[model samples]
Target: MYVQSENPVEITEAILKMDIRPKDLIVLLVAESDNLNLQALIDRLNEAGVSFIGGIFPGVIHNSTLHKVGVVVKKLQSVSAPVIIQGLNTSDYRWPDFTPTLSGLEKKVTAWIMIDGLMPNIASFLSGLYDRLGDRVNFIGGGAGSLTLEQKPCLLTPNGLLQDAAVIALLDYDTHLGVKHGWKRLAGPIVATRTSHNIIYELNWEEAFTVYKNYVEKDCDCKMSPANFFEISKCYPFGISKSNAEEVVRDPISVNSDGGLVCVGEVPENTVLNIMKGIPENLIAAAAEAVEETLNQSAHNDYVRHTMVVDCVSRALFLEDRHEEELEQISRRIKAVRPEVSPQGMLSLGEISSYGEGYLEFFNKTIVIGSLY
Candidate 1:
């Protein structure tokens, strides 16, 4: 359920009215624009004595529209309390032992992950998570942080609002995931010759910004500047090659002082990249396709189920007024399968999923829809 009010007391009251038992797990997705006094909310929820985990995102989704000043309160079923992993910004931080947590859960359960979007070691952290969990669980969730690209206290746990940290809840549910990004290659096969974590210093042995600007300028016949880089770069992202599936997109949010391109997620050294371009029609179609894929993967015959949509905030920005069309397509497709269920999720800084019996990944400019049954 979505609480339109941002007030901590009021939101907590609503949660209480829901009659959420002590064993129920709650996912509180907050909009960054709400400027919530997270501590107050946390205190209230704790006072009510309920287990929960959440994060502040660019926006929250309820039905087909996006809310910039509301909260999405979703109740989940987990085998254990949510685990908190700190020091995501530090490369050497030890990954905590989750054996005690996983040992209690079934061999194939769903894991809901929420992480700090601006942290540099997101890919590394996800890799470590997959290594520990193996293929025993399917992963679904997104990166949480403000669109301002600032790193701050975002993730929510029973302990407190945390920064440079992640929350992993081993849900006692099964989810079918569909991941897609309708970006076609405009230019490509450029190797990231010199790169650090999420910054690319060179592409094909040339200045990263220079190579990027050249291609974008030639395609649109316009001048590129740091001031307008983000505005223009939204239409053109870098896609990392993957064997049979769609190339994973990397959103270049800005150009640093050293002429390096800073992306939302990591771009490793020597990675081959393609400059991708998106059209509104294609993006909207891809969203519908995601719902169709999710429905196809689902094997349950139950009439009641839940749907979660993790779409990129940048995609919404690029779609502008037409973003609703993408949401509508998803809704229409989902209703065709489960008419009673509505699409609910967040406009995330980045999307995460273990795509199609494949490995876990952090993606940008993409849409991931997970249907829980």
Candidate 2:
């Protein structure tokens, strides 16, 4: 069951009115960057013995309509355990301490993860998790942050609100994952000559921003400047290629004073990078394809409990007015295949999934769909 309301109090009231006691709940909320009172809302849900895991996104999908400011609550029937790990900034971040807890769980488990989008060491965190869990658990989730690109206490846990931390909900159910990013290479197999964490200082021995500016100005016929970097860079992102899997895109958020580029994820030194581009039609088509892939891989086609979509907000910002069309495309495609499955999603800062036999990755400008059975 799913419910939506602009008022948090109303959301709690509606959940209380339900006759069924939900084993777990997932929340997708849209509120002013500074106005979100997650603690108050969590307290209300806790009083009723309702456990939940989710975060505040720029916008949320309730049914087929997208709401910029509201609460979308998904009542999950499967039993779940929510775990919160703090101190993501500490250099000693380790997963072995939590290995015993995860090993004690049932053999079959699916994890939904939400981490701080602005955390500098997201790649390290992901590597640690994949090393510990391996293919034993299926993963699907995205980064939780504000549209302003500021790191706030957005991720919600039963303990309260948190920042620079990650939350995982281990579900006792089967899930099928599908991922797609619809971005074609614009130019460059250029090498990243210099980098520090998430900032790229140089590409092919030239200043990173200089290389990027020349490419954008030449391809798009638009003059590039630091003030207009974000507006122009959204249409053109950086793609890191892999041998067998689709390229992982990194969104350039801004340009630095030293002519470096700041991206959503790390751009390791010596890594090959390509400028990627996308359009509305291809992006919508990719979303439909993602739905088809998920349905094809589902274990129980006759009874899919729910479908969750974590699409990058950069795509939404790029599509602008036509963004709703992407959602409608996904809805139509899913309905054509499985009319019983309902889709709900959030426009995330970044996306996560391990489709087919691929390793889990944190992607930008991508769409990830997961179907639970």
Candidate 3:
């Protein structure tokens, strides 16, 4: 069931009071940027004494809530359980369980892997995960969120706390998932030309700023150039490729002043890009289509029950208050169309999921859904 409240601990208490058992700890840890509030939520997780771990994302999803980061716990009572494996004292316990999950499965199963974005080995970790999972599973979700000037982020751990760690949930079962990648296409008519690899070494084959200046235009554009990414961040987003389906598997992350694009995950080199135009209607259509596919793909007949969304924080900068207005209808549509739909979502930097749980060919794309029932 989808639920939300100001008190996560109370939420846990409610779950524990319900049919939730200690072993069924499939909790998701996405943090709110506010340090103090994040700590309070972490404190609740520690008290729960559940074998749970997750990386922080830009936002958290629950029944009807949108915006801001939060934590969620979904307990599978009568549902089929995905394997939960943790590496206690390994070199990097983060990807240990994922290898088996991806390698063995030939169909589809989704996994939620929380990671350390600042880690030097982060790209490597993702690579290992993608390699092992193969086409049988999909990868989504994200690295933890942080306001820290240092590379380290406060990871929410099992001991009533947060730490710098990684966790994975290998869900190989009968389930359905849905994902919506909404970008505000805020940048004006500038094009991402002369890009080798996914990194924009040069825009228009000229210095990056020159390319940017050409886009912004005018004298005010010069001074604003310093924080160009900051100003137009809401509208212009960096598109990251999830599936290899050319335009089909792509989304954008925002850029920063250091010439480094602060995308959700690493935007690999040589990735073709576009300085997109964000139209409100287009964004809504994309979201609706993604959600519809999930419903259509699963049919909600014998087993479809819950859906979780992973959205980007940059999207909010563009949509402002209207983002939720557009998203609420998403909830309504799912409920109206799918009788078994129990949808809860987070408007965060990224999401994780897998499809058909048993479909082996879905490996390595960004997983948007997983099922335990």
The numbered model that scores best in lDDT is 1
State the lDDT of candidate 1 residue by residue for 1-373, as single tens digits: 9988857899888888877765678999999999668899999989889789999999999888888988998987787778898887887777778788777765577888999998877898899899998788889999999988888989988899999999998887778888999999999889999999999999999999999999999997889999999999999999999998999999999999999999998999999999999899999999988888888975672533678899999999999999999998888888877888888999998989996746999999999998887
What is residue 285's positional error in candidate 2, in angstroms? 1.1
TM-score of candidate 1 relative to the true fold: 0.97
lDDT of 3 by residue, 60-79 (tens): 65544663534565553321
Task: Specify the poorest-scoring 10-residue window by lDDT in model 1.
Answer: 297-306
Order the numbered candidates by lDDT, best leading. 1, 2, 3
Q: Mind giving the per-residue lDDT tens digits that candidate 2 earns over 86-140?
A: 8897878645355665677666567778888778778778878887777877888
Cα error of candidate 2 at position 274, Å = 0.7
Better of 2 and 3 by lDDT: 2
State which candidate has the highest TM-score.
Answer: 1
TM-score of each: 0.97, 0.93, 0.71
In model 1, which regions exceed 4 Å deviation?
A: 301-304
- As a whole number from 0 to 100, the lDDT of residue 240 in candidate 3 is 35
> Which should have the higher TM-score, number 2 or number 3?
2
- Quantify all predictions' global Cα lDDT against the true fold: 0.89, 0.79, 0.48
